[model samples]
Target: MRIEIPAKKRLVHETRVPIRWGDMDAYRHVNNTIYFRFMEQARIEWISLLQQSTHTEDAGMLMVNGFCNFYQQLSYPGELIVKTYVGAIGRTSMDVYNAMFLTSAPEVKVAEGGATMVWVDLITDVATPWPEAILAGLR
Candidate 1:
């Protein structure tokens, strides 16, 4: 099955992640789990930037859910361009997505995934509305 990302999702971050040899299985294609990891790396990178923009260590994002859809097989010895998108911003939560493609074939997406993330006050351990800086950063 295929899942479609938001047509109007904002592109928030982009990074390259090299495919490690050990990321593959006996079939020589990348394992399913690694795709989630790739998406995770993007999310963490973006969230870190968001936190920096907020200039606060007391607030952060929590990924309450995640998922991936693999449309093509990826092999080792290649690099992936991960594009992160964010949208559906709510009172305390937002939707995040990643579309990954081989560096050599940018037009062909190998996998895509997303997570529903919420903002939280780390010290109080409670959900909070997104900080203004974080909201500005998203836009």
Candidate 2:
């Protein structure tokens, strides 16, 4: 099946991660909790890249909400291509989406997930509006 990201979302980042043997559960498949970590790694990597380009100090993002859905089982010793997408840029928050596919089977998504990310002033610990550079980095 052809999976389409919503029109409102923009593909911002992509990375690949290897599935480690320790990531598996007793069922010999990837544990459900590890999927969240996989997504987190991709998101943090993307955010760090964005921060470098934007050069925003004491400014970052927080995952206010997050969720995931598993489509197919994932096993060990495989690389997964994780794609990150952004949607609905609000004043201080936006939606982030992630999709993971095994490198050996790029067309099939093993899992998908998302989080509502809020821009924040780390020093003040308060939500803040998206700066131009952050917006530029995403768009």
Candidate 3:
């Protein structure tokens, strides 16, 4: 049987994360919630790259929405290759997609997820337009 995995677009960033024992559940598999943490780790790295390139001190993005779908069970004593991609860009928001695959078999995806991030003004707590540098970087 063949499984239809979701197709991803251009890659924005990728990171490797080792599974910790505490990340597992009673079932001896990685907890579902930990998938989000992996995505967050990749997202932070992407943001850090952007910040370094733009040298901007402005407030970072706010995650307005997020989701994850599990395709296969992941166990500890392994590492994951988490990849992030740019999906869609709006005036003040952009969609970020993520996929997690076992390092042993990079072609086989274990989980997929995404999040909608909104640019916000840290001081006013209001949505704001994406900075030129940020938009360029995301493109």
Candidate 4:
């Protein structure tokens, strides 16, 4: 059976990153491993967006789980726009949806995925609930 995965245009925020020559593999395209770095960049932008608008004291949010699906090939020397958004906000975890697309070809979806991050106490290395202040910002 054929599965349908439609292109989504619900980017809450985006960051432009230039592809480096080192990102290419022997296949002459961006390496699959490099996608994770793109995801990391999007996640950092999402976190910073929250931090800047809110006054939360806790500055630590750790990724507990994440996965990605490579849809198409991305070559080096092209600009990649990493779009990110909060998919869901749970009691102690936040689900972030992210996608990487070519700046010149926005319709072409390069990759799409998500990450689940839990608010944690760095000193204790324990998860904690989403404070009301943070939740409000997420909404």
Q: Give the whole-model CA lDDT for all candidates, comma-separated.
A: 0.88, 0.86, 0.84, 0.76
* TM-score for candidate 4, residues paired by index: 0.80
State TM-scores per candidate.
0.85, 0.83, 0.85, 0.80
lDDT, candidate 4, equals: 0.76
- Tell me the tens digit of each residue's lDDT in model 3 across 4-106: 3246467889999999999999999999999999999998898888764322466657898888888999888999999998877889988888889999999
Deviation of model 2 at 59, angstroms: 5.2
Task: For model 4, give the 10-residue run with minimal summed lDDT.
Answer: 1-10
Q: Candidate 1 on 36-124: residue-level lDDT in tens?
A: 99999888888787655432589877888888989899988999999999869998999999999999999998899999988889899
Candidate 4 per-residue C-alpha lDDT over 1-139 given as tens digits, one digit per residue, 9 for 90 to 100: 2223335434578898889999999999998888888888877777677664322355467788777888888887899989886665678887778878899998888888777888886666778887777777676
Taking every candidate in turn, the Cα RMSD to the unseen true structure, in Å, is 2.4, 3.6, 3.7, 3.7
Better of 1 and 3 by lDDT: 1
Best by lDDT: 1
Q: Which runs in model 3 stand beyond 4 Å of their true positions?
A: 1-8, 52-59
Instruction: Look at candidate 2 and give me any clashing residue pairs.
Output: none
Q: Stretches of candidate 1 above 4 Å error? A: 51-59, 122-126
lDDT rank order:
1, 2, 3, 4
